[model samples]
Target chain A: MTVPVPFLLGAAALTLSTAMQSPARAQSAPAPQIALSCAGCHGVGGAGEGSVPRIAGYDRQAFVDNWSAFRANARPATIMNRIARGYTDAEVAQLATYFASLR
Target chain B: MTRLTRRAFGLSAASAGLAFAAPATLSAQTQARLVIIGGGFGGASAARYARIAFPNVAVTLIEPKTSFVTCPYGNLLLAGERTLPQITHSYDGLKARGVNVVHDWADGIDATAKTVRLRGRATVAYDKLILSPGIAIRWNAIEGYTEAAAEALPHAWIPGAGEQTTLLRRQLEALPDGGVVGFAIPPNPFRCPPGPYERISLVASYLKRHKPRAKILALDAKDAFSKQGLFQDAWNELYPGLIEWVPLNKDGKVTRVDAQAKIFETELGTRHRVDVGNVIPPQSAAKIAIDAGLTNETGWVPVNPRTFEATRARDIHVIGDANVGQVMPKSGYIANSTSKVAVAAAVAALEGRPAPEPTVYFNTCYSHVGPEYGISVVGVFRPSENGFVETPNSGGVSPRGPLAEQREQRRLEALHADAWYGAITRDAFS
Candidate 1:
């Protein structure tokens, strides 16, 4: 179609955005591989150290469910209840696996 | 063989030439130029649909960001489930689909001149303008927390606005055993209905593994949250000691936050200092909405629910978090869904056809409590006597009880969420 130049450009810009967004085919670290700073409180084994509960051996389903609950405000664990609400479902899964794998 | 192929190519070329020259032969009698401000879910979708429905239409999308980073899934990044790049998408795909994406900030809309002024001397004229610039921070809403203070105690309200998530994540990592992370939940009408609680879950999930001793303090303005019963059960069953939720009636309202000092003040003036603070301030429509006279006394655009056309302005449609659609939560899913309906109506109006009747839109907001555990609310909505009303018995919050099917449904919904994001982005840009 002989579209107007501006509209055509607009369409192209959006297409470019989509092209830039498609997930990468090359598999890499799915989550941020920053220094394992969590060891201080969590311990190296992913076991619960103190007030924090044991996250390593927990059920992945339970972890995901809990995070989802926090986001939905379905669950209430003061700071955790609030903190859990901040992550997307995907992030919750990534974290669940990350902590789960530490076991 | 060569002669036949050449002849066929020549015939196709001539037909294409005819098509290019015949704008009048298409649907629109008067070729109109549409300038769209912002390339978010609402603006991008409107641009694509407008171009498709009206072949003679000229569309331009002005947005400064090179990439459209979605806020819907950004929470995943905080929980350390997904990286920022996983949720980030560029405008390249939209560009390929024949959208003129202007990589510039929209300074002002010359409604009288029928032109949009850009930051640098650039300008674009339009017949119909669509502004879906999204919500801006009301920094003055909270005391002691200004734009600069946000650096230390990031609200992370605006997607990619600052480094609140990163800062909070980093601080959470560094916190000693028993460190407290305080989150001040804002009043209703914020962007996401269950967002504050979701953040709490992700943070708690992180702390449950790392700093088990650390606690999450959720100070709320509301008496209850979106899915209180389910979250409470999950927390108690999973990380009982790691979390404690304080509601407004129970002295949970936070009045002030000293960002530099890392202190939070309750309504009764009870001070609870913390290591990390996430204060989501009260919000309204972005400044441009107010400047354009599109917002009402409540500082949000009041639009015709069916079309999303601004009630105050002529031929201008406002969608996304900036608009006040009471029936719908100001979530990204709703914004994306409403944009489609608005686009259909806008297209019908241009073609001199009656707008579609009884538009029913769907919205599903999924949140991750830890990882595999997920909960969601799916609502199907249609226009009612007063405004948009949820379809009866079609959708509700995930059940509070225990079952494999419920969690499995949530897991599938997680994958479905990715596909939905992909599809919506495709519809908007591609």
Candidate 2:
């Protein structure tokens, strides 16, 4: 989905920065609106409070590799494999950056 | 911003013309007003999303209740696995997020004026209206199944103040050990496609321990249902010979009900006397939608797939179960999932920007069949020229297997279901 967020920021750096330490650093970077639904399972800022693992500070490269493996059915997962196949490469990268910087 | 209609401002129409006359000037200086009706999954999600993603938009949620009891885990309550308090949520979280939460019934909607009339003799105006007013039970849709009849044979479908669900639970508790529990399931285009099957599973799970000799008769209006294979597999594996599911082809459709008599009459004129009856009647878009002339013959509001804005009316985005979101089961997950898209589109419109382009929605519904057992279905849908169609080969149900080898998966999923509830409620209300 082409989510045109009103809080669009000029954080042209889609790549993760070492300075990112908390969710507040990521506030300037608009978490793609497409990623909003993830909070339904991963909790706010991807800091899950239950059996679902937190994805907030996941490694950037690891997040992308995981999505690729899930989409290709190369990884073992409960529901992520099915969900991952639905997103495009761009969306996967977008979500990876968003969550990586979410903390 | 949408042009306001000249009505329901808590003002006389004669005095209302000025409030809406300078819409362009007024909207430019003030934050866009997003007024939502209903406080369930869809409305709550939208209210939270508007505040999170578009803080510039002023969010106002109009719901009659101060607290909401969800229907998703209600079956667990029937099985004595949960209590109403566990599923009920307060609006304080949304209120904390700067959402204006009003506790009053939305009596009528003035579509032309972009105003909602409240039962408390007030009118709430909006720049863009999000109608998530959920489903309304079609009283007497099945013969003799009136509001009074509901007292004895509880539908327990809509979780309004949790009374119906509680009533059904009480009846189940009061039932005799060997008594029969009959279910009159409704047809398609209803809320939660997999709900009745889940309820049957949970009820059977309850009876297995308490009323060992009890029998459950589930009469389905349709031959097949969501996750039918998985649900049937669980029923056979866990509660064998205790539950009988009657399909429509096998004379399963219930045409009449007598709550006081405790009789469920099928379409073939066969009557079955049961100790407890769960008459899930046919449903339609809530009354406010119909009263506002937003519904079609299907008793659902049709909306633009990209924007989720009501097709018949501009600036009105109708989300949740009230809209004709076919191929998307009227599950709470869908309501929560699609709400962001609707809010995004509504905000885009308020800013004179284009609506979101792609039409993607996600849904995951977890059903707890027995102790430490959970099954789920995932769906990913995209819009086609005709309507929304499921993304083939993308979504699937949990693999069916015996609990011996899949015990960990099942147990983990049960825990995950609890986590899903926690995360979703927190995302919406907190």
Candidate 3:
């Protein structure tokens, strides 16, 4: 599904055409909006909590690599494997950047 | 910088809105009005999130009760593990955060006029309306059971620190040591899918401690239920020979109740006499939703999965237990999670911006079978062409086994359940 480029960071870089790009193509969609839902389990701003890990300010490449591995079934996990498959590689990159930008 | 306080997060969200200035089509308004009904998990979450995400929006939450007692950990109360005040939360926090917390019953909604008529107050107008009115019990669904009967044979399904919960707990306490406690479990699509089973487990926990020889007979309408395996596993290990679950095929569907006689008659003409009866009848969306013509044939409101906008109504969003067509369960966590999405979408629509795409929804239901014994089911969903689809392999019930690690995890999950109650209520009310 296509998500309009979110009006986060700034709208200066966006146009009507750029905003209409599918989520797969719009690799820079603001991460904070998507990351807000994660706060329930992963803690506020992905800062982590008891038993649940903190993803805020993680190495972007490492975050992408781990999610990719989970998506590809190369990693064993209880819930992350399934969640990883829900996002495209580009969306994952955006999420990694968003989390890394948190701290 | 390392740890973001809620105040800091709220500031960041407000700044994000100011930085972008929304879309060009948005009205040049200093304030927009957003009204939410039902002050429970869903409505409260929407009010709280809407206030933070769009600081300028005038958010009003209409609820008849000043405080809400959650159903999530209510079973623990029956087991005597927690007090009512612990599960109850006041709306002062939401009020302090700039949400107009109106303590009134939202009686009617005029979709065309964009106004909600309250029971004893003036009608409140809104630019956007969110209805999370939860579920209404179908009184006649089970013969011989009505509102009055609930006083004696309590359903205890609805959230609140009310007489129903207290009645059920008192009955359990008054039951004899070797007496039978019977439950007439409702069918599919009811609120808190695994609630009856959890109640059974907790009641058994109380019985084992106070009335060691007491037994529980669960008569279910459906052949299976959520986290059935995990519940059964824990029951076997925790309270063996104390609980018996009868499925529909086994004539477990209750047809009528003799509330005075304390007897439940099943569909197959079998009658079971018990010391206490817990009859959970079928359910439908709250009456207000039906009155507003928002619910479909199934007595549930169909909505655009991405926006939670009522399919048949304009400018009104129906969420929580009242909404259908989503693969997610009608659960507290789902209601809380979906409310945020609904609020965000409503804000975007009110601002004339396209709603966020690829909306991700999450639900984690934790059921405590006994002290330090819990099981859970987790799911992540994204909207599809038809409705919301659970992302494959992303969610499942707690792993089942006799392994020590699995047992430890169950114990930890019980602790997490307590923590989750604290966190979610804070997220919504505080």
Computed on alpha carbons, the lDDT of every model, listed in order, comes to 0.67, 0.83, 0.80
Best by DockQ: 2
How much DockQ does model 1 earn?
0.02
Question: Per-residue lDDT tens digits of candidate 2, residues B1-430?
Answer: 2333211111112222345332322222334579999999999999998887765467999999999999989999999989999999999999988899999999998877778889999998787899999999999888999999999999999989999999999999998999999999999989998889999999999999999999999987899898898898899899999999999999999999888899989999999899999999999999999999999999999988778889899879999999999988898888888898899887666544566655578888999999989989888887766568888778889888876878888888888899999998888888
lDDT of 1 by residue, A1-103 (tens): 2233223333332333334333542112221211122222233334554343566666778888887776566874323443344344565666677666544
Query: Of models 1 and 2, which has the larger TM-score?
Result: 2
Put down candidate 1 lDDT per residue, B292-338, tens digits, no spaces.
88899888999888888888876677888899788788876676667
Chain B TM-scores of the candidates: 0.89, 0.93, 0.93
Interface RMSD, all candidates in order, equals 17.4, 11.5, 10.8
Q: How many clashes does the backbone of model 2 have?
A: 2
Give the candidate order by descending TM-score.
2, 3, 1
- How does candidate 1 fare on TM-score? 0.74
Candidates, DockQ: 0.02, 0.27, 0.15
lDDT of 3 by residue, B1-430 (tens): 1111211221223333554443332223334578999999899989988866666568999999989988888899899988788889999999998899989999999997789999996899877799999999999799999998888889998965566787898998899889999999988889989899999999999999999999999999999999999889888988999999999999999999988998899998899999989998999999999999999899999999989999999879988999994578998888888888898788676444668765778888889898778778888788888688988656777789973668677877787676567667777887
Candidate 1: chain B TM-score against the reference chain B: 0.89
Worst 10 residues of 1 chain A by lDDT: A26-35
Q: Which stretches of candidate 3 lie over 4 Å from their true place?
A: A1-31, A47-54, A58-62, A65-87, B1-30, B403-405
**C-alpha lDDT (0 to 100) for residue A67 of candidate 1:** 76
